[model samples]
Target: MDYGPWSLVVDAGLIGGLLLVGTLIRRWVGPAQRLMLPASVIAGFLGLLLGPRALGILPFADQLGTYASVLIAVVFACLGLGEDPHARTFGRSTAAFSAYSFAMYALQVGVGMVLAYALFVPVFGTPDGFGLLLFAGWAGGFGSAAAIGSVLGDAGWAGASSLAFTSATVGMLAGIVGGIAIANWGARRGHTDRLGRFEELPATLRTGLVPPGDREPTGIATTSASSIEPLGLQVCLVAVITVAGYGASEGIGLLFPSFSAPVFVLAFLAGLLVKGLARRTPAWQYCDQRTLKSISGVSTDVLIVCGIASITPSLVADYWVPLTLLFVTALALNLAMFRWIAPALMHGAWFEKSLFTWGWATGAVATSVALLRMVDPDLDSHTLEEFGLAYLPVAPLETASVAVTPLIVLTGLGWTIAVGWTAAGLVALVLPFVLGWTRTRRRPPDDRVEAAP
Candidate 1:
């Protein structure tokens, strides 16, 4: 058929069509950004079903893989840019937040690993294969899962794809459910604190990613650098930071077997370091906040689009049960954390701080922001900024907690799945309030305000 060029065009058309559909779905769903799941999974499934992998009408499967790289980079950069160093400082509240976040992931991972180990040896009774390794390592990182799956698939494990698909679906759903619960809890409890007097909300993430004429210069201002070229030098700065961070993290990661922290976590810490270093450089002072804003916006959009494009529908259909369990557990945890923990830790606040915390846990910052925005559409950008920044600094700790536990595969699927259920049950019924209350008491309140200026 000699449809090489035609394949490329068709793939692009398909992706674009999916994007439009996703956008519409997002708006309809209300959060607008949360639709990344449906859009990406549906589109990816369509691609797989219709691509060379299945229908052979579009041979763009390889192309989709290439785009995944860009998606990862963009996501990492945004994550880095999103961190707020001021909020991340080792204050009592932040320290407590960090500790609690780590504990949560640790518990989940620990339970997951134990379950995996039991299932692998007793039911499956095979330890020498790549599937076992992939399953265990994947508990630490989805990337690891994908890598392991492909490796095992090559080694002739039939369910390698299913495992990878299941993990991702579970993780994403966990994120969303967890985020929503936190937001609602916060809404009910009302953890409201005004922005500190010393702080000014940031207008943008960096200088290079800003689109020209998209925003009025006077309308945005957080620092002196806010006026530089839109999407200019800042983009270079972000790219440099991202690459350097990725390299450094990867190097450190290799030193430890299960310590595969997300590259985005490293990039975020690097961005904070760069921002701090710039404080010393006169040139750094000239860096524009608009660049940050532009970079953040663009990267977010690209990542979302690419993520949707990368989804594989078959995975969702096959592994819906476990994925559903993970999501439900996350949602319950979010609520329990707020109802029991937040007030004790962040005392003297009238509003439910747990809501905000859940948003970060489940959906990361965007979902949190969406939660807040839904409550207050006029919610100032600074408030969102403050919360966004607060979330960044916790990335490393969260990654570590999630990665520490590894679950290998097993033949006894019933007992293995049972472990996951039991863990989820405990998390749902107990840990949230226990950890939340402990953190509340151990950490003293700082005079710092929680809300934005």
Candidate 2:
């Protein structure tokens, strides 16, 4: 029973099995297919049901919750590893997209806090920081929720991690279901020009598996036959950065016991530093973008399953009313923004652009990309292109907020922080109009390219 490191193997095997089962279920089960749920989401729900928290069928370790935090760091460390940041050119679309993205973050936090203070505190007796779960779950996804929840848990907010995870789960479900509904509604209402039948999508996409023909080679044979493999080298490089990040975080924690920075924040900075160094060396050519993406993807899938399994259902049940209120309020606000605000901000392919934003605001980047693919299969809408450019400016501010918000709340400045963030949100909301970034010209018919086969 003292499995130690071997326990990791067992847990990983269980996760793999669950992924396989989820894929099969999605492939054969009519309802799951109809809803277009990802295999990872299904696997996560299964983990929640079978793990110790729910049915107790699986012998998962209590430390599974911590896995998300660490895996998230690994995920962040791989970001922009082989990409060029300076290549992107920002224009009106990028400016508008960046503003909208930041505005969403500010509005979610502001509205969430206000509701938590005025209603949840009086009605449910929730903690002062309860409102943060909205932004942590919806905007930051499971990773941010885990990191921020860990910080809150240390600050005497009992069951914060479980509540945040629960919120994340709800957000993911809402993003997928709501996104699909919206896409369908758009198609029905003649708002979207290209809407494909869900049944027609490839099985690999539906099941989240790479088919044989589509599977790229794992690594390039950069090394001699007797030397270490290229894949091993990449893995080692990532491990080195991750370890350095962990050490830095520990050092910071030791130096500032009051406000320990999240590991993912440090890891991201380390990644950028490593990438910068690599760019100046011969090794830059050896760094494969595809392999890095695969690593990040696997980390994310594992993180999602572990995060969902780690949720403490009883904690969620206790605050169901307030949690429900938070979820409804956030969902409504996001929908309204996409319906009205997005059109005014983004010019070309406005509906497609807004749809992508809706997906990301509710879930994560992957969810948004998936929804985008559904509406614009060929990616001709240029939402992804504009988002890529906009993210360069938006990422630093977003990450800073994610890392610092918990610390501010922990210092008992929740109300002041909420007001400041709300004001910032209002500014971001109005900046597009003031700067004349709002759409003035109508979109031409050719711009809304039909979805390609």
RMSD of every prediction:
9.7, 3.6
* Model 2: pairs clashing at backbone N, Cα or C within 3 Å: none
The top-ranked prediction according to TM-score is: 2
The segments of candidate 1 whose C-alpha lies over 4 angstroms from its true place after superposition are: 1-17, 28-59, 77-84, 87-99, 118-232, 236-293, 313-332, 349-351, 373-393, 399-453
Model 2, range 17-131, lDDT digits (tens) per residue?
Answer: 9888888888888788666667777888999999988889988877788788788888878873647567566677778888888888888888888887788888888888898
Where is the poorest 10-residue window by lDDT in model 1?
198-207
Which whole-number lDDT from 0 to 100 does residue 351 have in model 1?
Answer: 32
lDDT for position 181 in model 2:
92
| Per-prediction TM-score to the true structure, in the order listed | 0.55, 0.89
Report the lDDT of model 2 for residue 151.
Answer: 71
Candidate 1 per-residue C-alpha lDDT over 128-222 given as tens digits, one digit per residue, 9 for 90 to 100? 33223322222233333443344344345555534554454455555555544444443443433332111121212111123465656532432
What's the number of clashes in each of the models? 45, 0
CA error at residue 22 for candidate 1, angstroms: 2.8
lDDT of 2: 0.80
